[model samples]
Target: MVIKSSMRRSVRILLVGDRGVGKTSLILSLVSEEFPEDVPSKAEEITIPADVTPEQVPTHIVDYSAAEQSEESLCEEMQRAHVICVVYSVDDEDTLDRVTTRWLPLVRDCCSDCRVPVILVGNKVDLVDYSTIDAVYAIMEDFPEVESCIECSAKTLKNISEMFYYAQKAVLHPTLPLYVIDQQDLTEGCKKALKRIFKICDVDNDGILNDAELNAFQRLCFNAPLQPQVLEDVKAVVQRNCPDGIAADGITLTGFLFLHCLFIQRGRNETTWTVLRKFGYNDSLQMSRDYLHPSIRIPAGCTTELSHKGHQFVSSLFERYDKDKDGALSPKEIDNLFSSCPAPLWGPDFHRTVTTNAHGWITLNGFICQWVLVTLLDLSRALEYFAYLGYNTSEKDNQLSAIQVTREKRLDLAKKQSSRNVYQCHVIGPQNSGKSMFCRSFIGHTLEKTFAPELAGNPQCTVNVVQVYGQEKYLVLRDIDVRNVSDPLLPAEVQCDVACLVYDVSNPKSFEYSARIYLKYFVESKIPVLIVANKNDQEEVSQEYLLQPSDFCSRHKLPPPHPFSASNKIKRDVFVKLATMAAFPRFHAAWILFYKTRHMKQLGFLRGDSVVWWKAGLGLAAATAIGLFVVKVLKTDKS
Candidate 1:
């Protein structure tokens, strides 16, 4: 489909020049389709309907005559006009000289801020026996705003219709933003936009557009596929002009840029503009605001996550960019993956924020987990990157299809089960409570690894994939620091899917901080709570609080504090337990049943109602047995 011009309702063309330059004759001839013997000082304004115009936009023609309108009125008209037609009598050399000295300067002074386009119209060409096209070309060079020069005869009606058409085209499909006439190349903005488009179309991340990729691009922009012969011809032309444009596999980025430059050089600005607008760029060579941040209303209590289609797209992207098939993206490969974006979405601390392999590269699971974190925290930014990454190429599909807005959190809690694949756990504790270490450990970082000079920054959040009941779920651990026990936690800090109250067991005063935080925040809320006594490798001290750690948990009817030590061997079982609690927030029995029945259902052991009832009874018995074992272990730790 043909992309329409920018969202302009109408185009206003104003005629300005010296007297007797046939400005009046041009308008009168266009309206009447014939030369008029008697012409007024200036013709009234004319409005052309959108259906009759090639641009499908309403056109308004205004006439300026020195004898009829004042200079102030002329300035006003110039400011209002989208494009100016500076008329000069082709046979009168003196009139053409006045064009640069008087008319062009006047436009520049009046419309300095707007930079309105100018169409140089040399009228009454019938009287000129010799060609003056060369002179007009020199004028265009001097005035960069001059879009095009047309020579016409108002009396014979020669090129009369074409003159106004050029004027309208100048305003709608402009070349100024896309081309540089003096340098004979594309403008920087145009090049940047096209480079992004090229990267998006390079599906394999090999920095080349193969035949299939090229055909997909054509179909996306023009709604038609290229014939095999035509595709080869395109490459042949590029190869002939640019030696390095073609690669062994397909057309390189250099070739793609050269093709666009060639199109603009051949006066095919519409061709380049078509591709740009189809990719969500406006006439200004910037992604349109509406396209970047489409209107998506997320009601209160709702959270956003990637839809199935979104997950599939990003997973495919990961597989494509993993050139070595090593199941992880190196630093260079990560750069190639986000080359189409304005900049890398993550920062130097990204490795600390997600699950990276021992090589310090982001693993596929970490990549997906990071995307899920962004969708939950900032949905608009996720949508913007989706546009940059070419997630939606067709007008029928949009970035909205890539996002899924969940029902209200209240509804999920009421149902006693969440359909979300991601859960956020806020780790709240006082300063130096080993909170950061606990959060980092969620992504597999040990105490020594967290202290690495490269991981020096204080990244408050970390995410990684965890298995709960044989299903993969992302768990985001946010390290929320409390300056003092007296300082209150913000409402946003108090809200989360799960709350982890961490305290340094070696610090005598640490247990009080965790206790106050839990009583202040999670005691009344439905959010699941987990108490962790960190730094267990050090000698355990009696907390200087009214109630010891075990007694505090018992009084609150919360689970016994889980012992942990970042200095000890890394353990993933604690993370799995936390994720399981998050998955089933309402009841402990449900967690046990979910974990126990997963394999049974997979094995088709619960196919009949009688078998399901029998299994459910077994599940309850097992849950009770596990509960007694956990209590026994807690009592042993307390003693």
Candidate 2:
């Protein structure tokens, strides 16, 4: 049998097991109408349709006759296989033992990333007894790598097709990618091309691909001539980013766009998880405690820096692999490296190339120059690794909990950084705690330096609400006197962007008072805050006096107190920079919105506030915005 790309999509199915376990018979029965009694003299390929619920996949079943060959050769075959079928005879218990002891190890060694799916098949079940079958089924459950176990008979054609079906499903819809693709240098053309393919493939014009359309589109665009049986391979990609059922086909437009981007594209598109796993990240998402943390150890920040000084790192890496100090990687050493549980950062193609070039002996130069992939630390690159690390194949949650958690943290950071304009900084502290002096530093005192040095000896308590203008575009500092210990924080009414909590470190009572107030009001406020430990330059201020506020901050889960000396220009300058950074995101967000609407204004579509009012319901939005602002300011001043 010869496999053809005539179907909508194709899945590569490789059969592996101990010799004489009916592996050849299984392939022959599924693809051909008649069974051959004698062994075929050469390799054969069979094309058959496997129904994969809502879609049919055209499978390429290769009857592997070289199972008894050298392990290196066996690995080459495993490298090409998308899904592996581990075959054993139900009548022969020893064949099953060979599966756990022999075949599984070779399969794992060959398929390093563990991306390929495996099906445990007990073949020739037609000749087996019930008790024997039951015992085999019980044993199959113990192997986590074996996705599903089934009894089949090639002669009777019992579950032969079903066994192949499982293989296709494993390839198209495995729990996670074998290697995460992090496209650091992704081009606009590549992204646009992928998008165009998805749109073109949605031939039905309904904005999504059904089973037939997806297969046709994949064939036309990627030139992946997979039949309907394996076209369901796109289902996993489709359903991943697709929305709720559209057009009875679950595949969404966005999902189609990213299908190849996530799975096939190498380089920047690859993930950190796969890269680290190659370097040996355990199944528990941990490394040896002795190993340096990835954030620090991996030369992720400067790939160019690593590339420039890479020879030294390469020498160190090669020393680990080149056993016996031969200055070369032998076939057995390469096999041992590949056979390790963690998947290779580079996949089978790289392995094959290395083996082919050195004639099965990898020179140290070849190992480093070709095989070692440098990890880059970038948001897109890191996210790809997180997607794989957070993945749980057994549970089909939204991209996995770990990915979601990481995404939220990154998004929050992005949101805070983007919208920096119009931010409010509420300066809270005990009376006479230099909160007013701190606010003054942002305005005229820093620029004009008008504050008298003598006034430092007799600091005035904040009497009324004082507002100091920061850079007009960035922020406004609101100095409120929180003298009344019983006053409510008004956190719900006043949504401040930054909370500047000041305390005089020279005065222990002020430090204690600030901590009490923070614990009472701001602990659960969900506001980004800075603890200002003031009077840091005072000669009498002891180490603990300055450090005590940090302790309070730590206990309250707040950021470490920023040591400040009002008279010190350097510390004041740092405070100014921090304030600017906190407020810059809002300013940037407004600037972006203004430019984004320039085209609308050029088209004379600027309808102003009334249009927004009408569209967003003027009564509710206007009332709420105004009400909140007034209530917050008034309540804050009163408190």
Candidate 3:
């Protein structure tokens, strides 16, 4: 069946360059498969049918004439375009110069927030006996967000199809560049090209991509299945860096971006260099002693620039080793660190040199100077050291209770002085339990009874998790169908803070499994679960498996089962209120503060080491007791 026009895929491509730069010629070549001797100098748009895509994708190409350079009209076109191609002729040096000086700035100004993908095209390669294509490609690398720079001949049809293919790829599967150059490094002509790309690959629109989404993306991009070996390698890198691990379903947006980088970087299977680079190590395995520090000992043949994060990482690592805070690592501390290092032996001579420098203790400067040489010689050992620093299979794969994991995350957020307001609530139930309708109504979708006949069919088509964002309370609702519980990419039961156990009040079997199976086996006590008895508006509500609030509260030891009817306003309001309170961030934050404060009070002296230590210690103790009382009450109710 033919897909609806609203669902038909399309991309608007804007062709821009200097006058007589083959912009019109190239368009004619792509559409008609022939080059016109006389190119019209009028601005026009043509829609070409792109049957190469999975469905028939309509591609609109706009050949922009230099005469229509009005600011108002240009901005309007740029806003509409999905991808912008800045064309330059290989034979014309002046036209290539205009690409950097004129075309790039205009594109960036109109599409900075829009984030429209850009391609730098060098056309008319057949005209030149020899070409400086490599030099142009190298120059294009300096331009940020230039997806790919390619030279194609419109007359010879060499790489012409490939050029438009890349244009489509840029629109369909755009990703941020792995490296970003500082603006100060570019000249005035190239100033507009320095804006970096933001890499967010949520192709499934679920706020995150799981294994299934990732696999789908691979198939769409490559027209082939992802190799099993490549999949494992990608997972290995993510497990090393992401604290949530594979069991957290897939990875976050940041993890997805890093995975994309790993795909492009050299040595695909080995992520040692990727790990070190992530933790502030430059390409040469060296960092400044401090952030923006003037004192930098740059080694020869080193191209890695100074990173601010690298300085912070080194300073924090050094502080951990230098407990005395004397600005150096003692022999005992060095030995202890080496014990955990992935490398078994540093060699007798190398160890002696690193341990005893000109100073009695090893300083940051001395440590970096020696480590650079070792990395240049034996890179394998450096990878081991990175693994020891927490990016390893052993540490990432280790299981932790939901409570402990949440507490650690809260502490990290506290350290960063921020709070996350968005919360994820997983909705689950057995087949035909009105779970989908409950989710639809909760997200404010209209629940007209006229559609009840359509909704009564077996609802097991949810192959991928469906996410709905709520307008109120800033909550995210994820519908994890019961059939997808075994899917590795779907979020685990423990990953969510709130459990929504939906069931049909008309179906006795639904209620039985909602309580005995889902509640008993899947939902954890730490998670606040709300049992929703749906379809209360039905004529015959089965009382055989249904119990009143007081009876159910006492029997299952859970909060009252919410008798929900999407059509009834009163029931809907009550259920929404209960769900909001359970998923609210403030409630979770309060518990986090209580637990962290209790732990801090035990430490006692981390607050200060002054004459008023006793006063400070006593004040903390008093606050801890109060928090403990509050926590105890809350714990008793399992809120």
The model with the greatest TM-score is 1
**Which residue runs of candidate 1 sit more than 4 Å off their true CA positions?**
1-5, 394-396, 452-457, 588-639
Q: Report the lDDT tens digits of candidate 3 across residue range 1-639.
A: 110111226978888888877888888887778877777885468887767543257888887875866778878888788788888988888888887788787877887766666888989888888776666656556666676668898888888888887776666544332233342122221111111011112333334566666665555434465687777777778879665545456666556545544543332312332333323233223321221122223243221211223334344455655666677777776765554343433443332233233445666653542443333333444333433442222122211100010223344233321122234467777787767666555433346632655344333111111221232222335566555334333335445546777778777566666665454554444455667767778853454556643355445445456667776453344344334434332243232222233233323334434434455446645644554455568668974
> Where does candidate 1 clash, by residue pair?
none
Clashes of each: 0, 36, 0
> Which of the predicted structures, 2 or 3, would earn the higher TM-score when compared with the native?
3
In candidate 2, stretches whose alpha carbon ends up further than 4 angstroms from where it belongs are 1-10, 33-43, 47-58, 67-71, 111-116, 172-639
Cα lDDT, all candidates: 0.83, 0.51, 0.52
- lDDT measured at residue 293 in model 1 versus the true structure, 0 to 100: 92
User: What is the overall TM-score of model 2 with all chains considered together?
Assistant: 0.32
Tens digits of per-residue lDDT, candidate 1, 1-639, equal: 122245689999999989999998999999899999999998999998999988889999999989888999999999889899999998899989998999999998988777788999999889878777899889888888898888999999999989999998888778788888889888998999999899888887788899999999999999899999999999999899997899975899899989999997777778998899889898778899888899989998788988878998888889988999999999999898887788876776777889888888888988888889889888888999888888878336888898899877787676555667788889888778887888787777788756645333576788888986666888889888678978888988988888899999999999899999888878888888888999988899999999999788767767667788887577776787677677657653343333343343421145444655466656644654555466468669977
Q: Could you tell me which 10 consecutive residues in candidate 3 have the lowest summed lDDT?
A: 397-406
Q: Of the pair 1 and 3, which is ahead by TM-score? A: 1
Quote model 1's TM-score: 0.89
Mark the 10 consecutive residues where model 1 has the least summed lDDT.
595-604
Of models 2 and 3, which has the larger lDDT? 3
What's the true lDDT of residue 220 in model 3?
Answer: 41
TM-score of each: 0.89, 0.32, 0.34
